[model samples]
Target: MATVTESAPSQAGTEKYIPFETSVNYEKVAVGGAFENGRLESSWYKYASYLPHNVPGKQPPLEEFQHQDVGLRADPEKKALLNAPGAVFDEITPAIGTEVHNLQLSSLTSQQRDELALLAAERGVVVFKGQDFADIGKDRQREFGAHFGPLHVHQMGGQVKGYPELLPVYRDFTAGAVDNEIKNNVSSIKWHSDMSYEM
Candidate 1:
């Protein structure tokens, strides 16, 4: 449960974020139309593009998902409220990237995981702060990402030892400033998206 404090503007702007005294799930996630129960659910309804397709038993392709209304498969009532984070909007675009609170990726039901993927898709990106990758472990990280779709094995960058799907990007300033340069620094500072490289 979140101890709601007075709403305040985020560092970037006057957009309000309900501050929490402790680490708590965001109380309300952005949702669209009401479900059969006459209550709004998560932003999953708007994130159809992000949901996985071509699973052996779970979910079908994007076209099939829309046609068959597979979004209703999971019972929202059964979902643990505390496990899901609340949506924090960005000042410019709400769908660009939403911040969520108190979601532990290591442990989530299939439905919960699906909701998360949908949330990410809807929001473009979902931010979870203070995540300890060491504690979550490589396997858990892979599993959590797998919930969205098959993990991507990068052609470039350092793989996480035994896990090819896990790419570690790091910089060692101690080596030297020039060592960190990317291809003569022409496009080193460019904003890149993983989607650009997707097959």
Candidate 2:
């Protein structure tokens, strides 16, 4: 359960996140739509191309999951929000990527958020420069992420304590105490893309 606080730190309106152990069975995660082989095969409705079988699966008798995806769905570049005043766009490659400068992901307007979703989907990837995103605190981070869709609570990887939506990703190099890295999926070689198994 979450508590309500009137402080500035509470970004999800008055509701503030109060973390506790969530009884999510990761193996039974495919709960968005259809079932395959007596088990759920995918989590979210894919708007783009994806191999259904490649969608990760768990065997039958799985637990329920509140599967989610981006909320700000729109035609790519439709709103032209990327062309804002003083904003600059540069391509990472001629084929598949882009980078935006002079715009902070944390302070984007609703229209800008819509356009950003389109830009990211169309470009494959879009990097926003100089974003002190992690430094903004978990409430703000969750608020920012929730704009796209309901925040996906991850199966593996460590979350920022109470904030399950905020997955703390570390580097390839070995660091942190042995006990610190002893959590599930916290091994040195984390071998998965960001939410690729979902959609």
Q: List ranges where model 2 is wrong by over 4 Å.
A: 1-80, 172-199
lDDT of 1 by residue, 39-153 (tens): 2232434322222222223222223121322224544442442345653323223336556555555656777665655555445666666556446666778887765655666
TM-score, candidate number 2:
0.52
Name the lDDT of candidate 2: 0.54
Pairs of colliding residues, candidate 2:
71-148
Which number leads on TM-score? 2
- List pairs with backbone clashes in candidate 1: 26-86
TM-score of each: 0.49, 0.52
lDDT of 1: 0.47
Identify the candidate with maximal lDDT. 2
lDDT per residue for candidate 2 within 1-199, as digits (tens), equals 0113243443555442233322323234434545555433434323111211121343233345664434245534454465677788776555566767887787777767777776776678777767777566668878888887666766655555556566654321222343355566645443447656555
